[model samples]
Target: MSDSNTSDFTNPSSFILQGIPGLEEAHVWISIPFCTMYVIALLGNFTILFIVKREPSLHEPMYYFLCMLASTDLILSTSILPKTLSIFWFNYREIDFSACLTQMFFIHCFIAIESGIFTAMALDRYVAICYPLRHSTILTDPVVAKIGLAVVLRSGVLALPTPFLARRWPYCRTNIISHTHCEHIAVVKLACADTRLSSYYGLSVVFLVTGVDVFFITMSYAQILRAVFSLPTKEARIKTFGTCGSHLGAILAFYIPYLFSFLTHRFGHNVPLRFHILLGSVYLLVPPTLNPVIYGVRTRQIRDRLLRLLTQKGT
Candidate 1:
């Protein structure tokens, strides 16, 4: 599987995706778990959405934010898994230049959106725990809607430039992307022209979005912890902490692997490309697969609703 043409072109007709450079032999086996996770992600997130929408009691600001998170996870996992599975199962890896860019945009855009939702969730928790009396007033339905709109806009506006930037470069070097999907740097690095600006811009967007969100989350949690500890009774403190456990788990599930993959991509020069690719793919799936489960297990309302639904179906 070599490039169909070796000559220079502003844009190749399509880019050949090499599923995972060093793990071609294990692709079928790998597809099993990837496909399984995709199914789980779909089922879990959709269940969350359905439960949240149907149960009027679950329509609080917290559940609203959870719905947003679920939707983002659905998009984020979907943008990559279908194509990835195609490559794995059928060896169908050629992606049109435009399609590739579209995938890249959606993937990155939703990632930022997901991060924003996490931040919003943190704020929701912070208000619920720290400013208990004003929580409802602070996160009214209109405010939540506005926040959701802002999150989508911020992520879309920031990621919108990525495709245009990548398209501007003459990709005369080769049309083969080393990783599973058309990642920003993976595609841009194939350009025969200078890619410093694109690389720097991508880096800046990561820092700008992730850095700011992280700072806010940290500050929110710090205040939350203080408020939780200041409660008069042990039961009050335990109950307050319980409310946030799922959110903390979801946050860790997303950020830890994401940062690891990002750092490995940019700085882990000695790290194997296959390891990085696998981690990147897993990170995309893990949060989506776990978020619903974490929330269901940790949130009494969700868990009760979910169990009741299951029991009804069984009966």
Candidate 2:
């Protein structure tokens, strides 16, 4: 522990992260699954990016959005996993203040960006299904590029305040975070100063990003469902719905755990601290780990291309 003298307390040299309160003995055992998920997330997202980029057949708006999602997943998972593993494996738990903020920013920024991408993907599917003739014209290459840019910009700008807000507070209290990573709320709670503004801003950003995205996604799917049912044939309806299955799965994967963790942290007093921390850690891992697999298995184009590449390698 550092000195609690006024100057030292105000701006500590580094903060210690106590990974998962009450789970100290099982940190090593717990890390096995986290490490495996991280590795799979890395490989799966990279594979998605590679296949999407190399295959000309995949040079479309949907695939482009998928590539963006993959890239975001890579960033989101990478932002937290290495440090978490270090904490679990080697007990290297000290994180510099600036680096902690950086990690926090990336984690939240990309999460918002990923939610935006999911909305964009929903829009892509909606346009493709409902207005097939206009899909290309509505979402041209330049349009897709602009959407990608907007998603990144929106998330980055919204998340930019988190670290600054956190930094303004003086940490007269202890500088030990009780989780594996420097989540904004967890880090800010250590401050002796009023953190209500920071907490409100964080909550507002979550609603602005995720709440709005979810509404749009739901509306898009509603329109899509209407259009699918209007189709003349049952087979056509099923086929159209099939195209959306992967996106739906990906959305559920990302948001379900995310919302659970958020709610647990904010309101679930009865929830065990270890369970919340573990859920928080797993919340970051599960989406990235599952997204590529969902798309690869449920999406025929990606699945075929992946199989072809694997077949070639096997031969």
lDDT of 2: 0.93
> Top model by lDDT, which number?
2
Write the residue-wise lDDT of candidate 1 on 192-283 in tens digits: 88899999999999998999999999999999999999999999999988889999999999999899889888889998889888987898
Can you write out model 2's per-residue Cα lDDT over 9-100, one digit (the tens) per residue?
A: 88766888899989899999999999999999999999999999899989999999999999999999999999999999999989999999
Cα error of candidate 2 at position 243, Å: 0.7
Superposed Cα deviation of residue 151, candidate 1 (Å): 0.5
Task: Report the number of clashing residue pairs per model.
Answer: 0, 0
User: How many angstroms is residue 129 displaced in model 1 relative to the true structure, after the best TM-score fit?
Assistant: 0.8
Worst 10 residues of 2 by lDDT: 1-10
Which ranges of candidate 1 are over 4 A from the true structure?
1-5
Cα RMSD for candidates in order: 1.3, 1.6
